[model samples]
Target: MEKLVEQVWDYTKHAKFYSYRPNYAPKTIDMLITLVGGKNLKVADIGAGTGNLSIMLLERNCNVVSVEPNDAMREIGIERTKGQSIEWVRATGIDSTLENSYFDWVTFGSSFNVMDRNEALNEAHRLLKKGGYFSCMWNHRDLNDPMQKIAEDTIIEFVPKYTRGTRREDQRPIIEARKDLFDNIVYIEEDFYFHQSIENYINAWRSVKNPYWDLETKEGNELFEKISQKIIERLPKEFDIKYTTRCWSAKKYK
Candidate 1:
């Protein structure tokens, strides 16, 4: 499974995947800024694939350390932020070589599930200053929404079985898993709404190398073909997919 994930991460260097990957919601970025009480705060974005969240932090005038494991993704991050003064490091959450109490905030956006949760949590604790914030953000599909349910169910049936089990849309497990690492744990959730056309939605999935790589078996491909047909036959040409962007912040006590 780990090898499979590594292969998928390597494939993310492709032009289509690098260019069309979905970004973190602007409102989610604003919430992170608000949680830290201001901008220009030193930040470390863990598992910072292609610098999606790092770019968001940089846009707010914050100095960002983008830690990513995949060389391809890290290069894209560096390329995109060439003149923006962002520090791009090829590192994962667990082995980030940063010293203790180094950053004001450590953020994980849509990349938490791919990490060793326990190691990553401890690393975040080790890197944050006293009273510093640790945040995890994800753009989750609202399973209760009819359109979201359709899209999600289709993807689930088509993708590799393990991918479905390994990742989840809910944030509770991650928050609960890391609760003991921080003294003052708090959660804040905000909806980042977007109207995604059917093509846009499909392309977004295709662009995520991990998920697409997992959908490679003959059975999986057949399932995906069915899904694509269903999407074209039933879903509106343009429709809305609601996302619940859940963010949890925990502060280290002095």
Candidate 2:
């Protein structure tokens, strides 16, 4: 997972990674908005890759601080957010450069899986004011969807053994971890629907530094390319891709 995280910073500087990778859905935006009960909520987005989630919060009229460890990714986010009112910090979640009990909401979107889960959650608890919410949201793809199925299967078939099972985006552990730190635990699941051409889909997959590409053997590289080609063949020019955006929210307790 750490290797993947490092590669992501390198890959995301490319146009493909910076522009084509999936963004959070408006439903995700709505959930956070309502969770904090306002548009101008103070937010700290931890492990905020390229400010994807932070940008969303800013658009909803929230004051946002984006904390990221990767300098390249942080730069992309900074450039994308030129003229916007967001503070970009070069720090990780475990030690975000922010005062304690300073924010109303601390958010992690598609980022918690990369964090030291316990430390990140504890940091969030400390940074958020009493009753302030800590929210973590992730876009989990439905592999059953046609185009998505092909992509997932191909990646699974070719992904390097080292990267396998490194990070599972399960919400349970984080939820349970928060239980002892915060009161009033809650979970919400929302769906986002989209239609994409196979070209777009392929572009999206290749945009991220694929673990399949990290396979160190010639056989692995060959296998990955073969699977990529097969994906292009099997997927339709246009197909529906559904993602479930699962969010867990909890309020800091005294």
Candidate 3:
């Protein structure tokens, strides 16, 4: 478990590129907030990298505690969300060090896969009020889309066995396995389009933790360069990338 925490430091190099990543679908977020009771609720956003979801929650009037372990990511999150109703804590999801039974909700924004899921669930249970909710979500590129298919082909051309890892998996089964800690499980997904310049789109890939190779390695650098060049040749200056924001949420049992 400690090793997993240490692995999070790899994001230090990719921290700056996180902003180029897509935000959660607005309607999806609104539905989540509504399901979890509503605005001005207390939220503990675990693995809150660079304040993407945190900023969205803040915009909806939620008092957010952004728990992030990576120094580079957390620093950027703090700077981006400065002066807002937020508290920045340097902590991992499995052991947030937050008071027990205090928060209305605990959430992971594109970050649940890095931690031990069972431990993260336990930590969420510990931090939430009796009826508080726990949720984790990720924005997945819609690979079936024409433009996205080009990106997929580009990646496969470099790493033939590339896999998206656990982030793209169905999380319902994992959450349901912890029946003792939670109940009333729910899953939601909404498709949305993110518009960005080709350059920013390429930068977003820099933030991804590629399973095939480490970006620091010579091979990985070459692979990235190749993909970037291919993308530039194929894509327009600016375009929309279709994405599906998938979220799984459960109510903490009293």
Over 118-228, each residue of candidate 1 has an lDDT whose tens digit, in order, gives: 777888989998878888877666678778777666667665362543345565566576656675666666665567777777676654545554454676556666777
Q: Write the per-residue lDDT of candidate 2 for residues 1-254, one digit (tens) a residue.
A: 23334443443433425455567678767866886785578899997777778888888888989987777778888898888889999777777869999999999876776657788889998899888998887776776766676777766665535242323456666567568787677778777777777777666655444444633458756765687798888777788788777777888877
Task: List model 3 lDDT by residue over 16-65, tens digit each.
Answer: 99988989999989999998995699999999989999999999999999
Considering summed lDDT, which 10 consecutive residues are worst modelled in model 3? 1-10
| Model 3: how far residue 67 lies from native, Å | 0.5
- In candidate 3, the residue pairs with backbone N, CA or C atoms under 3 Å apart (3 or more residues apart, or in different chains) clash, namely none
Report every candidate's CA lDDT.
Answer: 0.72, 0.73, 0.91
Cα deviation in Å at residue 205, candidate 3?
A: 0.5
Q: What is the TM-score of each candidate against the true structure?
A: 0.82, 0.84, 0.96
User: Which stretches of model 3 miss by more than 4 angstroms?
Assistant: 1-9
Q: Can you give the lDDT of residue 228 in candidate 1?
A: 77
Model 2: runs farther than 4 Å from truth?
Answer: 1-18, 156-169, 207-212, 215-223
